[model samples]
Target: MKAKMEHKEKKIKKVWRNMNIGFKSDLHEI
Candidate 1:
């Protein structure tokens, strides 16, 4: 159970990082 939660957190972290990069790039382009 603990391992499953850690796996989910890692997936979420990767998604969040990608979103942050996209947002920053869009702002810079504007």
Candidate 2:
């Protein structure tokens, strides 16, 4: 059960990182 939670956290982290990058690029485009 603990392992499953860790895997989910990792996936969430990756998604958040991608979002941050996208936001940064969008700002640069302005």
List all candidate RMSDs to the true structure. 0.4, 0.3
Kindly give the number of clashing pairs for every candidate. Answer: 0, 0
Candidate 2 C-alpha lDDT tens digits along 1-30: 999999999999999999999999999999
Q: What would the TM-scores of all predictions be? A: 0.93, 0.96
Clashing pairs in 2: none
lDDT, each prediction: 1.00, 1.00
**Shift of residue 7 alpha carbon in model 2, Å:** 0.2
Q: Write the per-residue lDDT of candidate 1 for residues 1-30, one digit (tens) a residue.
A: 999999999999999999999999999999
Name the TM-score of candidate 1. Answer: 0.93
lDDT of 2: 1.00
